[model samples]
Target: MSERVMPGHTDGLITLGAADALWVDLTTDSAVPTASGAFTSSPAQARMGYVLLGGHAVATVRAGDGRWSVSEGEVRRAAAALNAVGMDRQDLVRIGPFRGAPRQECDEEAPLRWRRRITGELGGPERAARREVGRPYHLAGIDWRQILVEQTRDGTHRTWWLPRAVVRLLDAAEHAETQARDAGDRQTTNPEGPTATPRPYNKELEGQLYSVLSRKPGTSRRVAGWACAVCRGAPATVLDHCHEHGYVRAPLCQSCNTLERPDHLYSNDIRVANRYTRLFHTDTDDWLRHWHRCPGCRARTTLPLPHLAAWTAHIACRSLRPTHRAPRGRKPCGVLRVSWTGSQNAPRSGLLTVAVDCCPSGEHRVLAQVPYREAAERFRIWLAETAPALAAAAGPDPLDGLPAQSRPVIADTSGEGLALF
Candidate 1:
């Protein structure tokens, strides 16, 4: 490798005496030092007095009395320089005025406050690289978190011992760079797509769509006019493709395109008593599957009030089958369903139907029927006052800790288990 260039002047010398010290910058070779008062010192002064240094280096020993007076700033600078060169404790030549400061060498571990700051700056422990003594290696895919730079000399793995504050600063810089790269990728992938906050945008999905569109010019225009096939309301932002068939299925909204997965939806369906439905389109002319949609735009089809869904599912599933699994048809029993009866005007009325069907036969027993407005008010009350008490009773899923791929799929025995509409 090439020699590392150091900053500042590097041709200054320090000469210490009994009463004072002299710092001389070498302007020319002819410039000679004249014998001055108290310039001649004892053997102690000769051994420790003169230090030939690069101009940037500071002599920690006081010239007047030879007292150790090291400033915190100078100590910090020395630490930073050592870190820059990837120098460990063994490589530390000297630091500050205190040459025999054993306590300072032992205090390498950072305090709790700095540790937490470093962790937060690096985006938690998941993103932080584990510091270990090992053979030198290169970074793997998406593994750039090892911001603590290292350098080797004489064919050995060099490690740096930096101050906590300096390490935290390095981690913060890494995080900023990562954020900038992600932002740039987002712009290049989909400049006109939805922002990532309130509505998350999948950049990978958008990039794939752009790649496919580049291969087929007119196909982009055809899909551009199509609405989200899943939601049927939002503008189609991504080209949804089937991995099994390796064919472009239909254009879907950001949410539908990103969140739709058969396995995940199936798991969620089991957990939430099949309240939310996932739509799948096989072909252009194939009958479009429908989920509950808003009366205005027919876009909002996701489960409403998820806090209420868990408790309702728990009670309903138990009442129907006494087991975690629901009955064959997957129709949730003892659940509330709101229906509008009259015209959509001032005189309109609504009904709340509560039904339960436990047996295999397609017969449901209506337990209660009430005005929707009154029932809605009561539902809000129950949600606030009763839900908290039943929260723990809902408990965790049996497959909570299992990996998604390892979790067994609960096969639907009934043919009508999946809802087409």
Candidate 2:
């Protein structure tokens, strides 16, 4: 693998230190951004530090002489940066509300409030490279949580650690969320809030998009006549945005933007759009014609969600009659593991996770979750069509694994499925 590149900040440009720097907003075209600051110490680091440290950010740190003399401007920028990450002013910066210090928010915290959670210096000369013992790649995907950076550039070379209180709060939050989930079900109660607040739109992002469009002559006006920004084939028209956040996501064609829209809409995450498009195309007849073989059993299968349901149901119904040997003796084979890049399942939308593993050992890796309703449809359809065949030789189904169950039977319809009796 190639070594990672660290970027620096150019004048008048706002640097985004997150891994998905491309998704970062630009105030204007003149605010030219560089990748240098993304690696080394910069304002973005402190902002990330403040958040990761659980909102305890002080403007200044103690000097060698033991005098706390950090600038007010630096502190204000730190507060602004913290607020930018989906926090409201009320959640962070406080004014004239404390009993002790006049500037409670700044003075309440101990010295060097912003602390680094991820290990190792970001990057630098051979000395810094040696510190990286498999460093967690600075950016934490679409979670929007940035890595905290410590400004140790000063000759002192001091190291900072998270205060005990902050660690407890983060641990508690995680534990509560975990207990609430039951086999893919969402948390019954949210620690975040009764109803989560909507995030503000990013002007820097808007300007960045305008810059990309304005690069070529009349591209803005020409987009309506061209293909979608995502699939890049269908004619484009509508502007995709989060109905909740009221922010523009992208300029997509009708199909790309319409999956689970309005009610199931996700924020403007780059990965989600890509995943949605992949699953969307897979459901089409064209994609099905090109089949993939499963790695576990080496069986060429159709789209998993439906194909799995179909094959399983056929085996189930065939065993209901008799003469068909029990399949429990055979090994329970054929497993598919699916990792989704995005979803309407809010909390997990941006994070890459294992959505489902079909069959047994989790072998076939798919990129999207199979909708529950669609899977059920395949089972019902297969059982209906194969009812009459259960007695016809009782030939073994290549996919059967589990033994049969006796249940209400559908009338045998192998001939035409038209008997109303």
Among these predicted structures, which one has the highest lDDT?
Answer: 1
Q: List the residue pairs that clash in candidate 2.
A: 7-35, 7-36, 7-37, 8-35, 8-36, 8-37, 25-204, 25-205, 26-204, 49-148
**TM-score for model 2?**
0.19
Measured against the true structure, the TM-scores of the candidates, in listed sequence, are: 0.20, 0.19
The per-model lDDT (C-alpha) reads: 0.29, 0.27
lDDT of 1 by residue, 205-242 (tens): 32132336547866644443455565453445456543
Q: What tens-digit string does per-residue lDDT give for candidate 2 at 1-421?
A: 2222134422112222332232222211211111222222222233212211112222123345543232333223322433343322111111111123222121212222121222213223542574455333222111112312133326654332222222222322222222222113221112221111112222222312232444667554344434444444344444443222222344544334433221111221111222222333444322222112111111212223222322322232223212213465543222222222332223233222222224332434333433434433443454335333322212233334312321211332422111110
Candidate 1 matches the true fold with a TM-score of 0.20
Pairs in steric clash, model 1: none
